[model samples]
Target: MPRTGEGTTVRITIGRLAEITGVPASAIRFWERHGLLPVPERRSGQRRYPPEAADRITVLRTCQQAGLTLNEIRELQEERPRRAAMIRAKIAEIEERRTALTRAQELMAHALKCSEPDIVNCPKFREEMTGWRPASD
Candidate 1:
């Protein structure tokens, strides 16, 4: 890491960038290949990133945790005209996943109270399955 004059033009090597971002160097390079991170300036053959790269990596990590694919993250980063559409699509996907998870929870809860030797043979469980519809439908 190197700083020049009151942090107005500070730069850090790739290793330092990874240290601050908690991302592996290989992963950072991968993102650069995929256009997720802008190519950094090279100082004496070593990649030197501005302090802001850490913030960009944080955003990438956050988006990944929120279930956005790398391509989706790239689209968001590029600020394409279809950004809103992509977000809406992701929201719909999350809603469907939530619905499926809720249904699974209900089934598990019922299983705990079920007295039948086999849950599949339980009358209540059978009725529930008959009425069950996938979220996509």
Candidate 2:
């Protein structure tokens, strides 16, 4: 078993945290320098984070994946309820975009395998494009 810190519970090492969070150690160090992550306790000149810090880093990664800017994420993190709501909204947006992309892929696949000499003139393609009208009118 790897030695755990005494008095100060070291849940993860800097390298382990980086590996699990998919964030570079340098980035984590930068975040610490910027006051994004609380200053972790040092043991033998090496920084170690508590278990809760892992959760925080996960939330940070989630915000990043959701397209939230770093500043926006930082602000959101300052408020718990708002951060949860923002994450929920981001998840919904991602799902909606994924559904749209899947539909587009299906349509394109159908078009590619279509037996029609001209896919543009295919009835199915025509039906799919029928509802599209210029919104600028």
Candidate 3:
């Protein structure tokens, strides 16, 4: 049984926190260094975290999976005044990516059904590219 620290709350070691959150200890340390996770209480030179650390790590993983960079995540977590603006910016980025992917999908779908020997020379393909511009444009 794990020992309780500060009343009946159980304090978990770093290894246990990683296991509970499915995050590596190295990553946990990295997050701690990056200010994503709060500094843990030290017990005899060993780090001990409250159980809520697992929940915080879960949120961090979820934000990362959503394509947020670590710096962006840190900003999102720490910047309360600009949080709404940051979220709006992220939403715009996602929408832009979605539009680009959808355009690519449309091109691929047309290519699959076209009977043209060379897609580039196909009149229909060229017509389909009417308003399309290079990424650099």
Candidate 4:
């Protein structure tokens, strides 16, 4: 890994960028192909990215961990004057998914304490999980 300089314009190769950012070279290349990362200046046969590339990679990693798809990240990167609305919709979607997951977790936790050997056969579980029915039933 190349040592970061003090306010100097130091560019590093893709592998070095990966080492600094803890991202894999393949992922960096893939992001470049997907327009997530701006194409860096090339020297000889190596791709050299500016220090700012690390920040971009951090943002990408964050968005991905927050459940944004590659296309969604690309959409965010390429602002077409409608990004705010799109972002609000995505937030709404993430919120909905988070809510559903919470409910699923609660249901599973309750199921663990259920006395019935077959949870689906438990009336209490059925009562708690109203509006859902087993396909076999």
Top candidate by lDDT:
1
Tell me the whole-model lDDT of each prediction, alpha carbons only. 0.90, 0.78, 0.87, 0.86
Give the number of colliding residue pairs in candidate 2. Answer: 0
Off by over 4 Å in 1: 1-3, 109-115, 122-137
Ranking by TM-score: 4, 1, 3, 2
RMSD of each: 3.5, 4.1, 4.1, 4.8
lDDT (tens digit, per residue) of candidate 4 on 14-101: 9899999999999999999988999988889899898889999999999998888998888888857787777899899889889788
Candidate 3 global CA lDDT score = 0.87
Clashing residue pairs for model 1:
none
Q: Which wins on lDDT, candidate 2 or candidate 3?
A: 3
What ranges in model 4 sit over 4 Å off? 1-8, 131-137
Better of 1 and 4 by TM-score: 4
Total residue pair clashes for candidate 3: 0
TM-score result, candidate 4 = 0.77
| lDDT assessment of candidate 2 | 0.78
Error of 1 at 102 (Å): 3.1
Q: Give one clash count per candidate, in the order shown.
A: 0, 0, 0, 0
Off by over 4 Å in 3: 1-6, 105-137
**Root-mean-square deviation of candidate 3:** 4.1
Is candidate 2 or 4 superior in TM-score? 4
TM-score of each: 0.74, 0.65, 0.71, 0.77
**Top candidate, metric TM-score:** 4
